[model samples]
Target: MSLIRSLRLDPLPVVTTARVELRPPIASDYEQWATLRGESRDFLTPWEPTWPGDDLTRNAFRHRLRRYAREAREDIGYTLFLFGRADGALLGGVTLSGVRRGVTQSCALGYWMGQRHAGRGLMTEAVRGIAVHVFETMRLHRMEAACLPSNEASKAVLRKAGFSEEGLARQYLRINGQWRDHLLFAMLASDPRPRA
Candidate 1:
């Protein structure tokens, strides 16, 4: 790779399928982010945090950007944007958070998408791309994910990304408000990659 190409995550991998573009979120993406997320309020509330339904202000968006920047520097994990490649319309967000390096190089994968974008194979493709980026660019050893037992869609995504169904834990995570059971899935460096 050229020095500039090596220095930047440019050529951003576009990660396009027939309908989606999985790439890094930019400084100007907050507007669409708010729209898609806000619209999915009811659909996502059951699985995610209960934020104010219509409270995505510019200030909050700036705060999110600041956190993203800090996380990038600290190598916490990456939060990518999902969009329609042809028109560049925002769809949702995908994250690989809590990254740890050294002997136990591993990170946890997490993601959320708007209701309209759900059920398509876009997320599966996005997850595959994130796994590739994690193992190749970040040089991580393992990637793990937690999903509600009832979330078949999420389980499918992990399986497509080459994560094995490890086990189940009671009250594995606090979802929305109460503790919820989560199934654990993981992918090791030795695992084979999966196609979109």
Candidate 2:
């Protein structure tokens, strides 16, 4: 193969819902991303993993982009930032990680919404849009997600996106510096999607 073709990464297309657009983060998004994450720190920290000391630094964002590019090149993960379609405002981000092929054909879904943008149902729309990209475009067989049992908003988003609750996982993940139990949810390619 030519050098360019050999270095090509898997396509990560922009996905659009009614009010949100999902696309991979670019270098220009650094300022907006940093601002949003910084502002939402208090609101998001309770449900997210403890932030690294330099989490919002430009260097850290560069590292994130590098990691994302590497993951895409390896066909192991995809990360997209959600923006308001009409005003082009950064709303949040979604990640489809830990992808497995072969008989599995599955990956994990993770997301976060800016504090200012929460409670608007934008996340549900973004999740649903990404689901279509996952099942139809990426051709993955299944998508999985988990959230702390106490997170009613996250649970509602998953349900609205047509994911069925599977079961609870003990100490499934570390959030806010503590191991927390999480409720697992999954959706298969054959599953019916909610109307948009």
Candidate 3:
């Protein structure tokens, strides 16, 4: 008989930093997540795929939660919402997606922050925390990230978090309604971390 594998993580993992906590988004988080995304629309839209007309609706959030749960159960991805450690304020979100195990143990990293939280080094902290989890807990070999070449803030965040620029991807993804080119970056499990 062939051995079977159980691919579920009960009570999804939560990663935390000195100032923030990152956990999967739950139904209780809907209002905060929606409010922050709504307020940051103009600040975020340029770097993101165009939002669905009902993106902030409760029904949409329910759909998102279901997908996140399914991906987690399949060991394919983890999407986490960041919150202030002290006040528990909603900060933003980060995701480790497109996970590939076996020969290519790697995943893609992506994140977004509220406009008000920008320029505070919070995203850098979140990225570092997630990188640790990806490397140590998940034992993944590599993590990749991509951003519009013009998004200098994102590039800086990736750099500070120990990811090295890899190259450019032509029209890698559709952002704000158009296919856009992106600068790619990657961090390997064997790479040295930038000292704090």
Give the C-alpha lDDT of model 3: 0.93
Candidate 1 residue pairs that clash: none
Q: Which stretches of candidate 1 lie over 4 Å from their true place?
A: 1-19, 52-55
* lDDT tens digits, residue span 127-183, model 3: 999999999999999999999999999999999999999999999999999999999
lDDT of each: 0.79, 0.95, 0.93
TM-score of each: 0.87, 0.95, 0.96
Q: Please, what are the lDDT tens digits per residue for candidate 1 over residues 11-41?
A: 3334556677777677798778888877998
**What RMSD does each model have against the real structure?**
4.2, 2.0, 2.0
Candidate 2: residue 164 lDDT (0-100): 100
Measured with C-alpha atoms, the lDDT of residue 109 in candidate 1 is 87
Clashing pairs in 2: none
TM-score between candidate 1 and the true structure: 0.87
For TM-score, candidate 1 versus 3, the one ahead is 3
Summed over model 3, clashes come to: 0
What tens-digit string does per-residue lDDT give for candidate 2 at 1-196?
3565467766777999889999999999999999999999999998999999999999999999999987877778999999999999999999999989899999999999999999999999999999999999888999999999999999999999999999999999999999999999999999999998
